[model samples]
Target chain A: MKILLYIILVTILLATSSARYGVVAQQSKVREYRIANEHRILEEFVTLLSIPNVASDHVNIRRNAALIIEMMRRRGLEPRLLEAGNSVPPAIYGEWKVPGATRTIILYAHYDGQPTDPKQWAGTMPWQPTLRSAALEAGGTILSMPKPGEKIDPEWRLYARSASDDKAGVMAILTAVDALKAQGIAPTSNVKFFFEGEEEAGSSHLGDIIRDQKLLEADAWLICDGPVHQSGLKQVVFGVRGDTNVDLTVYGAKRPLHSGHYGNWSPNPGLILAKLLSSMKDEAGRVTIAGWYDDVAPLGETERRAIEEAPHYDNELKTQLGLARTENAGKSLLELINEPSLNINGMSSGDVGALARNVIPTTASAVLDLRLVKGT
Target chain B: MKILLYIILVTILLATSSARYGVVAQQSKVREYRIANEHRILEEFVTLLSIPNVASDHVNIRRNAALIIEMMRRRGLEPRLLEAGNSVPPAIYGEWKVPGATRTIILYAHYDGQPTDPKQWAGTMPWQPTLRSAALEAGGTILSMPKPGEKIDPEWRLYARSASDDKAGVMAILTAVDALKAQGIAPTSNVKFFFEGEEEAGSSHLGDIIRDQKLLEADAWLICDGPVHQSGLKQVVFGVRGDTNVDLTVYGAKRPLHSGHYGNWSPNPGLILAKLLSSMKDEAGRVTIAGWYDDVAPLGETERRAIEEAPHYDNELKTQLGLARTENAGKSLLELINEPSLNINGMSSGDVGALARNVIPTTASAVLDLRLVKGT
Candidate 1:
């Protein structure tokens, strides 16, 4: 009993000491980071945004690659241009080594944006940055609209093609490193940057480039390619679900048949495909595949604990998503992202628009994405 | 023990007698169906084929409806047209009472063909019917192709919008009744023909018509729709899965943003929608919806036994369908078809074809069909 009382006393003392240390650290937090060179980072971002780096547009892509190389060299980093034959645009690689750092981090960001249809955009062109009031969770910073007359405030975030997806991520990383440099606090670890022009095109030749480049090696890979949490809190993703694209085609008759004339007699590929898809999972969302669950890796205790610990709003989410009720396994957001998944990305065949055509489509195809976790 | 033995013997004897009867019935199956007048049937089918009843074209739809009414009148059957105001073409109801019939059977079919994109059909006109040789399960059958003057034949079936669909089914039903008249063999059951016009439009107003019409009343409804089995065997369908269409839309921003710039920070509605869809199903094809199966009815013992008794070629079917394995229940076809289903019919938001787009889709939508069984 005396030993137990003494241990409790020590625990309380340690807890008090820890709390005090945390308070001191919070009080010493820096208010401003590199004010003298703040405009320079913004200038570099605008410069990168100025170039049109739409996917498969080789000329602009090459120009952007050169510009990125120049930016890296200006920061005293060794940057190189790597090519992957003719089909894919070239990639840019840069490395900054800390004198005594053993660990290295690789930052990946794509520079290209989807080709824009001017009519679909709200402004004159997609290449120009537009700014507007966006939700805090969606990047937080306010920005200007891309219209010709729209003026941008220095404090405002820029909105443009290739602006947020990856380019913004690229700029943020660069700025973070630059801020550290201004404080005379060099990176605590070796850092590498890989900017690719073909990520939008499924990163067609990225694996090849990664395989060939010795300098691109890293202890950790940080993919700047997804959204921040909906709560506006930044998260460190330990891993991501790898994806493979599946194009499924169901062939019916050689031509589109009238659903009316063939309603009961001719094959309806749409209905057949639907049945086939539904068969995979029961109404309860349980997969009915033979031996499908056998190979799946069970959730780890850590992941389970995280899921239980996380704040959840399943009921609210269901209402917001216009769902009558939350889906199975949707009780936790972590489970929704961590689990293996199959999605019917797109489905097409026959007439399914304004004017309904009673067509038994000859061929029905569904574009699907299967997200596989590390285990299965 | 003696009584048990006697019961077993009696059961064996009864089973043997029933088996013998089944074999005899199978061996001496009905070989032919006679039409009242083959020439008239063919001529009418040909005339109906010539009328271009393209969907959404009201003038053509009305013309076809008139022809159907005229045919019923010529056959000495009293027919009435029920038009759903502000809706598509009207439904045609024909009734004939066979003297001394104890039961009633309703024949349901639609009269509509898919609209033709002239560019799709080469050297063939949508309205013209041409004689062609099509290999049949019973051998080769000379049938009519969509366009006139084409002599080429395809194996296993003729290719026309309405050939094997309801139009042909309608012809089959009409020919059967006509045969009864010619042979002086009155139908054992009262005949009610409900030929619908808007069946091609999801038979949208048929429910209202069924509720409103007294003349169209019947003990049982025989939907002469869809197709015969792939094996070309006659099938009696007692049930069909009912469907509900749901359209989903997800909004990320007021406008599409460049994926490169906002890829990781701003919400990509396309990606969000894709992730949501993916979450609904897993790699083995399971829906992940929470209450998706709340009202699902389980298969009964009799249904399970029927499934076991049903003939199936799972391996052959998998190979023929180019599937590694069956998706749905992964059970027998009978078992699989006995359940409800959810299918992604169409999904669209951004550019879907040709090359991949890297922009964060501002909005995305998917059309889904949820199929329900009898109880659900």
Candidate 2:
């Protein structure tokens, strides 16, 4: 149960469509090797998923790291936590040294997840991983835990906070290591595992931990994050855009005032915010803020060529997202993402809907997410 | 105490600077008549203010009406409830017929107040009116209710939901009657009182009640609402601007998505809202929307002359409100108020401040207040 839960559920989720659907037409190596031992991997994955892993959740985050450490211990990998501070989410580190391996590579993944309002998730909680017969949008049905002899459908999805994120990356890499040892395959390279606890939290302490810990040294590192491709094919991302957040606030009168009494006189914070935010973007969705796009580096020939060669799925994506249009007018999604971008993640002022009142709010605030390309 | 509480406080609040502060230099009619009976009026005002009188709160709204009904009964005026519907806030109606009166005037005011969020009120609750030595922004000190014989500070300010709004209007009109009876003065007008319970809620049922109740007949409806001139002088306003509210909302992807993953590819609702709202107003804060100002009636020579003659206190108001700028670049406050105006009372999308997350919200909304001049 432990073996199959850890190996099959999470690891199989993000595998290429070829690997995922190959079982229906013909048995893949994973099916052949684990056909009789499927329940073990399913159980191990479920147990690990049970722990809450929001980066901001100090207690539950540590609990998740502890469980990963124990899992590494059972596999004869001496895992140690590399932390910059007691409160910071630690980076769990371990390595397998091959007898005559010359190349050293580090497999990197984050155990932490984006902060979530649990109410946003439907039919499930962030930590309470559940198996669905299909995607929720496609009319999925919840399924109970399969007994040892029960059939496990490969198309069934596990819905949870970190299901498709780097948590699945952690399990996939670990399972790969397990498969190598089980097949008595000798390693061609020295393998090191580094599981980060705060990638979703901006990885603020990641550099500090890497600088402090000597064991994290590697010739090359492959970060397992983000998505594959919209076509369900695997794509190795070379570099990710840098991210930063800005919290902007504007003020009105010292107190909430009747809009009718002061509508033409008092400056409303919400109107001020709208004007200010609008000033940052033009009609074509290009940021109008001064110096916004001035610092971004130009894309090189090789990088531009790679983007041109990538799949063109903007039209398909727009249809799926129910959007008749997207930002940056003529630019494709691939090309647009390569440049620096600004997006308003959230905004708030006074109240709306049921609690709406005819009064000018005291203040208005917005959370802006800025994504940067190279050199930006 | 009973007589003073109802008369001195609310009646004196908006009675011009002369009536409010004339006691030290010269005793006004209100002060001279209510000197020994001051606490009675205050207690009554505070007790009425204590009731939750938001129009939407049906249960508490009726409680407010019942209290007002009893207050009128004790004053020897016959009061009756005028309701168009069962759930609608009832209008408290009463009248006094002076035998030799020629002019008949309906003293119109609203008892219901703007919906309040308690968190916005500082150092006090909306329903718990408190005595303050000065305005809250002026570092006012909270004071206990003055005893009957104790001196009442004519300058002291009362803080609560409807303390300065139409509720104060209700008490003022009623107290004027009390003052007449106590002083044995015969009023020259047949006075009628129509205290509406939902003016702040747009008075949807106001026309309905007035049409149905034959007792509401009067030569003129003197609406005891809004404020005095900015110079703290009484100004008899002729006609008021009409008001309407629009709840505007924009949609995004059906669910919240990780901004870093989908930001550039997906359109953000907040940015959409910002751009949309900004299009409705220009840099000079003039409405840019098509036909927004086309229907507004042109001001006549009399109205324009009145605006020109009004005291110019824009600079003083700006300094007091901590504003370095005002809307409609060249327009004065008096001139702007005479025209139509649009204000964003509140706006919201996802969360801000502490609960802010790195997710693209599913929707963004704003409450727009449109105040129209005559013919609009």
Candidate 3:
């Protein structure tokens, strides 16, 4: 029985790798067109990035939607805004029908960017797209925008708020369409472009807009968001870990109290919160709460074999991240991501450094992000 | 043996209580004079508080010292500014000789206040002394300053940055001297006044000033700073807990990474810090570090008796603070304070609430305060 299972796992892994090779071949053609039009593509992307696209900024968000519509029109894809009502930012919709296509795939991306404090950005402003010689961490210096026909390094990073977030998704998907059209290469499937304007705002009105627009039917959705693999290798993730956010606030005294006077007696909210959060995870960084792993579905033989076949680059990643160890002692990164994970997006209590005062704060708050894999 | 120890403890408790009663009787005359000149006393205090006293503010800090010197001279005590050189803020010194006194006592307080952000002050400005019917937490409304010969409520709170800190100490000490002179009641000891102008700046030049001034010798030094008892009962404390502060910073990636893309895979500094901190304490909130409690000294017989005799108000305090439990389970607050403690003064990573972004922060930092008991 074990030998038969092993054979089946190897067969599945081989099939998956062959399919991935075909996608890579297609991507190379896409890459060629992108390289030829790097200047034009970057200029258009920079122009789109210039507008502030915070979801709450209604006027600016509409400006982003309008600009996206124009880009789609220039590509001869008739784009229209789909909105549940006037109060919400509309989703930009466009389509290209491949004759004799067997299926339709909706390319998903969002134009809206996360709210950012411009002061937190170093040297460059969030809305002004500036090119850096390399990643900022690599001591990258600011580079002037490339002149027309000037060579652009693919490794040169663009510094902007939504430079690699959802806005990058929209740019990449639309640019792929432009590349395909320019190369006279017709896709084997019908492609529908759906650019959302409020993904960063939690997509609260997404269901409403989707329901109101009856023509959004498609066989599958290709979400053009998130980052490439940390190794800079292209990857096709079949399913993303579902996510939910929880805001936790623990209370201490009703008002701030002098720490010197009531240090031991008064319960400090920061310490209390630390203890509470600590209780959720153990020394190996596994969630300790009851039923945390109880509902997790076991991986199939094929999935296990695929994970085993994946490249082992934890050492390289650890060195790049300046970490000597990982959360789980012996488990690989792929194995860990396949399970549910809890991460603290942010945590704060009182102030730190020069602004810190000797006071027991009234409250401590933390925002936790829980990521769930399939079946869990 | 237990019965004999208990009897001895009772005797020491009685002796301490009797001594406390005698001091309360002596304070009656001081309280009487304070009540009679309430308006005048408040007016002078408010005038002193109106000046910005941050130690870095050279001109204003000197103004505070000069005002204190003037106040001392008005009471027939010759005063002078004591300094190491021209660089640091000066310390105001004054001496009052009581004829035939057996001992001299030096009263210490600081005129300079901590650096404050005016924006943090609600309704009132930091340097502007504002009178309120009660504490701002109690929804107190602003009130006009009392006119000459007008009645002033003792319960009325004065709102300013340094109102209750060392400035309150300065005011109370000076008023006690005035009360003794007005009533023609001489204190048991000759009093020396030393008001520091840079205590908030960590008293770097204090030893220099003391070394240069040979007349600082006194039988006892009474420090008048910090807050009153939380229970509203007047009590005296001896041998303050020594404090040492350490700043801890944990690193994640060199740059912020999107939580969805890199979370679980990339080490989160905030989570890493939380795990590190949690390892230092246990479920009962006792420090679990290898030698955290090893250096703590056992209390003497008298100290143990005093702690036993002290009121058991933990239940009342717990109710007031909205705490269902406290550290160390059965141990009283007094017992806990007599032992060394570790507290997180402030902690921060990324941001919380509306400003919270789904990004793994590059670093997390915490200011830890180590409180050492005597002989630790």
Candidate 4:
């Protein structure tokens, strides 16, 4: 947790370097504080990780929000829950004001985690944080938490659902503020901490929450989510594609029919659905839907330059993922993400396995996920 | 039961007339026998229908075969069970020999019924034969079975699974023989009885049973199955489309992944299946699979004439079936039946209804049923 805080703060510090020497001194002070208080920081993070934070899980998610609010209060940030409605998970709003601060930076993170099935996890449960000497893939053996005077390895891994997702962002952002306060750093921009509780649930109520609360007025928002660069540097994404989903269904006869007596005579809903879905994309993995790409705005000069300068790591990604080829039509991942995309999230009809019977199903359905660029 | 037997025997007699006067006389004698022995014949049929004859229900199917064999024994036909190995329903074989007969005709029918869900039946169960004063759709009222010496209404509907399918064939064919014997009339041709026990399950083991027994040698097989013509004259179909089934499955990533994180980068199995299935047919509902219709044999002059003379009931059928348009490129249902066909029996991937989530499925699958005419 201490090491994670240093990396997140380093990313923020590197981006806002008004003076190189002054930033280096502040970085050293934060590092010194983190090292001195490693046990306490790790314990606080472990406490946070112990709580189940699935956004839709109302009771446990509320418990998670309460714990984080208390953690913020301990840091003297005057934390408050910015509720979006009765059922929606509330964002934790807090501020650290500095004397004579010129600008305000909203340090953004999320406290919620993805919905996970416990059985899918390897040798561990999703909410139970287990410390490992290294990654599980690297033959790491589980170990107990270190005693106060015992040595704690910064390289040790923690296994849990949100141990590395937005929960780590929450931990890192809070610990960074703790380190800054302890080191007595002064004359920096006032930092407004905004820890969202529903980012993993696609943050459907995010805009409503921000508008309703009116507490996000700031110079810039620094999101402490997503992965670092593949080259092992902090990745600072300029923008991300907008994501949304749609459900599709096609009908056939009102009731299931014997395929032999009917077959081609009565329409098969599965075939109808198949034809419909297939018409949306071509053989080259490009969408053929009429005017699908028409509304997409082209990349700006700086955006094009940024894509060009990004690492040529497509092959590395493919290799790591055990894929022989990719859906590439003279484009890289960085360039392709700038456009729109359509994907079948899921689909179903009658049955496919042992329970499958020889009857034409009445209906077929699918869930489609669409990623949009600027206009589309 | 009495009226059904009369129509079936009339159809048989009408097709095999050496002299029109002789057939008419025999038909009257058969009608007299049925009229007098209606109660006994109905009792025997009810006993057969009471056994749940779903082809896959091992115990019940065998009970049906056993009951049929006993019925043949009561008629002194020297009945025997032609066992089709363990785990397969057995066919019941019996014969009646006429001295000086130059030809033998096999009366073919199936005792086994389709796999039926009783809940779908209206006001009745699949195995419980229920009598109604009229058709169920015409506001039929449930009626008790007639007492001994009471008048029987021949037009009353007897509802049960396989009541109109091949089980009715079994009853009509068997009762016809009883009528002939009771009236002291000998068939011009020697008759062989072949009551199949597993026609509804695609008869996968039928060839093995026939080859193993070698008891099916005959001049002709008169299969008492299918429906009467739309014009209500007893129908005679020269041939039917041969049916077969195939299961299909398509691949995707090894595990479910978040659509936002993976989406277009990972190929969705549902889309792959959709594209593959769509490639099989076009807008006019003709299969586009390469060489799909290459082996189909053309109809002869007699078959072509028969189709032309057959009622053009396509429009009526469409209206009855609640369809605005039929898949008619330029041909009728009769003409299309003469060609091979491909249909999706069923298909599935991931969740489609309430449980559908934003994850790319691991696999997609479909069951295809192909119908063949003469060659294809």
The models' CA-based lDDT, in order, is 0.57, 0.78, 0.77, 0.78
| Residues forming the 10-long window of minimal summed lDDT in candidate 3 chain A | A1-10
lDDT for each residue of candidate 1 in A86-182, tens digit (9 for 90 to 100): 6577888888788888888877777876565667654335677654455333554534333443433334445566676667766665665564566
Per-residue accuracy of model 3 over A134-249 as CA lDDT, tens digit each: 87889889999989888888778888878777687777777766766776867777878899998877889999989888779999877767556667655556667777788999
Arrange candidates by DockQ, descending.
2, 3, 4, 1
Model 2 bad stretches (over 4 Å)? A1-27, A31-54, A118-159, A171-187, A300-302, B1-27, B33-35, B130-134, B140-157, B228-235
On the 0 to 100 scale, the lDDT of residue A148 in model 4 is: 94
Models ranked on lDDT: 2, 4, 3, 1
Q: Give TM-scores of chain A for all candidates.
A: 0.77, 0.89, 0.90, 0.87
Q: DockQ: which candidate is best?
A: 2
List the candidate 4 regions with Cα displacement exceeding 4 Å: A1-81, A87-204, A222-234, B1-202, B222-234
Docking band of candidate 1: incorrect
Worst 10 residues of 2 chain B by lDDT: B1-10
Candidate no. 3 TM-score: 0.87
DockQ of each: 0.05, 0.55, 0.40, 0.33
TM-score of every model versus the real structure: 0.51, 0.87, 0.87, 0.72
